[model samples]
Target: MSAPTLAPYVFKRPWLRNLLNPLANWYANAAGYRKLGLRADDLISEENAVVAQALKRLPMKENYDRVFRLRRAMQCSITHKLLPKSEWTKPEEDVPYLGPLIAEIEAEAKERAQLDTLTVVKNH
Candidate 1:
């Protein structure tokens, strides 16, 4: 299971969120993946079974786009070149497409485990 995140706690406070939002954006931009046309979610490692299942559930078009993005990013990396500005992923376009599905899958798995281990009490 993933460790708990402080993000929601910080996000709940308007003052903290306002203070952190710019820093978060700056960090994301400075990370440089968007310059290669990859979204932040695209940076997630795909080798895990949960992620694999989540990937399989993606719409065909998004699945195709994801593969294309990864290949293009790899090629750019090998060539030591970034995509042209127009091709770079814009902030608004860099949304999490796979994260929700992965989280859903993990939640379902957790629920299934809970059900499997459930004990029923008999009332006669």
Candidate 2:
């Protein structure tokens, strides 16, 4: 990917960044594991569980990480067997992609909880 087109796509809304960061981080870490010559497919169970929990809380139809991975895998298999490359644009798939957003919200909630604890401590 060249810098020109990539840079434009890089600087989007902060809220989206906050939302996608966890999935992005998860992808990055998985890639890092691959770089270290480890197959991370066996590690998907834990991520799958988190993705499942997140989906219940998401109140939306799509979960990017969960759905996208499945789409990519299916596409890979199909293209290699039945489909043509010209016909498969990786299917433009996405999963709930909400893990990062939830983490951020949860962290903020935890901080507020701690602040309330301190306030109670001061009252005592």
Over 54-94, each residue of candidate 1 has an lDDT whose tens digit, in order, gives 99999999999999999999999999999999999988998
Q: Please identify model 1 stretches exceeding 4 Å from their true place.
A: none
Best lDDT among the predictions, by candidate number: 1
Q: So what's the TM-score on candidate 2?
A: 0.33
Q: Taking the tens digit of each residue's C-alpha lDDT, what string does model 2 give over 42-107?
A: 224434544345456654454444455455556655666433444332212322246454465566
Give the whole-model CA lDDT for all candidates, comma-separated.
0.92, 0.46
How displaced is residue 6 in candidate 2, in Å? Answer: 15
